[model samples]
Target chain A: MSRLSGTGLTLAYDKRVIAEQLSVEIPDGSFTVIIGPNACGKSTLLRALSRLLKPAAGTVLLDGGDVHSLPTRTVARTLGLLPQSSTAPDGITVAELVARGRYPHQGLLRRWSERDEQVVTESMAATGVGDLADRNVDELSGGQRQRVWIAMALAQQTPLLLLDEPTTYLDIAHQIEVLDLCAELHERQGRTLVAVLHDLNHAARYATHLIAMRDGKVARSGPPGEVLTAALVEEVFGLPCRVIDDPETGTPLVVPAARRKTSVQAEV
Target chain B: MSKVMVIRPRAVVIGAGALLAMTAVAVLTLGTGDFPIAPADVVKTLAGQGNAAQTFIINELRLPRVVTAILVGMALAAGGAVFQSITRNPLGSPDILGITSGAGAAALAVVILGGSSTALSLAAITGGIGTALLIQLIGGRRGLQGYRFILIGVGMTAILNGIMGWLLTKGVQMENARALLWLAGSFDGRGWEEALPLLGVLIVTIPILAVVCGPGLRMLEMGDDVAAGLGVPVKRLRNGALLVASLVVACAAAAAGPVNFVALIAPNIARRVTRAPGPNLLPSMAIGALLTVAADWLAMHSGYPLPVGVVTGGLGGAYLVWLLISERKAGRI
Candidate 1:
């Protein structure tokens, strides 16, 4: 297990500036949800923090050491990422697909040990895709397939997991199921997670801490109730919203007021 | 011997078995040439018990062609498997990048210029690797899209083919009938001189690819973005794979005069047989070796003698069609 902290991250894509002079301390062992409308740099922030994108200025420090300076396999051993829409080799079984995650751990002479097997088996079991271990990954339904992919990321056995839109392709039921699995993994493994989620309510319910982004800047960030207010949602999402409390989780719930017809706005 | 012969698949097991049977045919071919040795005498000669005449004929005449076919076959199949997986295009081969045409054209130049046989082989190998490198350069750094790579390769093939056709028109060059057949891609008249170089090259090259390309091949399969994210140097891996594939093609083409179709078929056959998604190298090499030997044997011993290339090209073309039809039938296309 490992913990990551420290930042002074200024990230940009080529010449198009995104985040500038950004710094934040991510506390260890917490579920952090980054939520914003598309193109607000939420995903870009995650990419920078995970060392997938180099900061134009500043550094991302993992456990008091520079993340980029660390050996790739060592960083991989500590942190795992499930990028949005990863393509697996077609026709590969779920078990074989999961087996690939052990690549960083296994070297030429030290390949495929019992520990690798146990990790993959336990991951498939923990992610609730144990039965799908033998099934062709491509043949399973969207939600089942997503879990299989999570099992692959889990098999890395990293203490920190980052997911970019894990619920992108799933239906409502499947989205909840996928997030529920993420929540379950967080609870069982005591791993810190940072995910870029599209659904605000889901983010509020699942995230212990929430960061809202607007136009490549952190608009607000704190406990979900404080950050996801009606005024903040309207300002960040350009949507008028009413806030309510969830009966199940006691998280702030956002209800969109209504689609504003341009003609009605003109009348107003 | 362990009784537990792990059954991989019927097609793979039987396919390899058929290839071994083809090796016998190649040996039989050796003994049947002029100054022929009888089958029993060949066995005796191999065992160091035959008469002098039997020993000379068996040792001198037959072994080279058989060995040549086996080595070239293994090389082509290995090349095919790597090419297909790295490109993630099942239809891909190093030949698709026009390395074969470059080798053939170089060989053609040497033969027409009356260069020694060794010079022709050397030229073919040099030409093949050079052409493969050129293509990789064009597709290097910021990688070329799959369709763009294929387009460039097709253009390269067309240019090399034109060069070959143009060179032949330069003089009143009267080619021997055997030479003409060889140009069409044959293993007919080849002997030990040809097989030896191919075998030496394969012994060095195949194991290198197996070891070095093992990790890089997986990186290639994961697509460049993810592979790079995983700390693989993408362009470097790409270059390494393409280089190995080109060398394999060059050695095979130089030895066997560009035996057609096996590089295109072996990997697919191996993949289908194993039911594994990524390219299965060992199986591909086995299938490639089997296909070439079987095609060569069938060509020599069929209803009448034909160049091995003609048989391979014809069979390979039909296999392509059958594959297309089957995929279409299964709605996989």
Candidate 2:
């Protein structure tokens, strides 16, 4: 069963249509990863689902109601999104930045409360940024900064979280660290996690549900073991590859075909 | 790590200090002049204990000008804080962004065309709102963000300044002299007529800014996507803030003839003093009142009297140059 789903969503910016008649569903309590080639409308779909981009046609339903029709704050209390890039206000501390996530729950009369303070503390600790609370966000490393941003989303305390290319700018180790944190949130906290990722192997290894896209359409989606076959990868990503089981996790992994040795050589 | 407190004690202390300083300047300003009432006498007169002559001087002659200065300063600073926060740029105050220039040009037009003071005020407000809408239209539908909006505003300011200079040239000798004095931004001959209107604007706008828009604007500094993801109505909030800020800048311009840099410098100074990020609206308003009152006092006491605008213009110009140099050194520009 799924609590968040889209039906016939047509997403566009200005006059340029990125996708038409697209539909998707995020399973309840699953770590879902979406992977596709560049400009395949993966991020557009995520934006539509998160209600950042209003769909030109059709609807995104959250809990059997149109998400766009609901009050924004009400939707925010149930769902959170970490955008691809967000600027930290200059001279902001890690704790202050995380505490801003409690905005939806706060109001003019209802200022910051003890619950807000406790939530901010726990969010920072969950993302291993408790010690960096007093440090400036500008002074943190890329990996630590990413963790702080995730901690902010965690502070929102939404049951459903969507991240658009959360690991895009990080080193490989940081990418894996972030993915591990997402996986932990899904497994231990039973939060529904949907993320767009570039690394196919990581997506396959970590995602309980995998979605592959091509030309603004979902080419295949299911359990990673069922959806991440060599044929679907070749069709979706246009890469000639062989699929093999990962030794440690027993999940399907792709190995690109080796290029033939060139016979023509330039004279030195 | 130590617990991070939501409220900063330093900001509260600085706010209190600024309020006290403003009160001191107000009292001192009321006491100085050719009549030269003592500060103690000024306080007593304010409390209804003064002699008839002292009461007439304090109540009738000088008090209105001081009130106008305070209200104009608060309006300008509040407007500046809103614009800077919205654009996320320190250089995005009303004066730099052409908002005051728009009001100045309209007020100049009314003066040159022999309009009443009431017409002048209304015209200034219309001009300010029109300029904001023009900038918004040209800035495109992407909403107010980044350096693009600031650059467009800078361009608009240049155009409006040229218009103002041309308008000044068209007036007759007597009208030209009057327009020039107004352009220099003086408190001479100002009375309850000017102060009351500004007070009305403040009463209407300040509460809305504090209670409705403050928290959402703070969220907007993180970027639009993050703000929207947190459920802030981004477009509506930006437009509403721009409208309120334009009204403020226009009203202050009508009262004080575009008093140079209180709007540009007050919020920046408040942010530095408080050592807090975001708009710093209340502190900025307090510091603004202090700066204007202090500048007016200096203008009155200087061996050669000058318009209050000249004092602020010289100081603000220097501050601008220093800010540019420091921002360049910091690699922010």
Point to the candidate with the largest lDDT.
Answer: 2
lDDT of 2 by residue, B104-140 (tens): 8888899999899898889889888888888888983
TM-score of chain A of each: 0.94, 0.97
lDDT of 1 at B101: 85
lDDT tens string, model 1, A1-268? 2366535678888878888877655657778899999998988988887787789988888877788788776777778878774677766778777777776686657866677878888888888887777778879999998898788788888888888888997999999999988888888788888899999999999998888998877888888989999999999999988999988888999999976679878898
DockQ of each: 0.33, 0.69
TM-score of chain A of 1: 0.94
Candidates in order have lDDT scores of: 0.77, 0.90
Best by TM-score: 2
Which stretches of candidate 2 lie above 4 Å from their native place? Answer: A263-268, B1-4
Instruction: Count clashing residue pairs per candidate.
Output: 0, 0
Q: Give the clashing pairs for model 1.
A: none
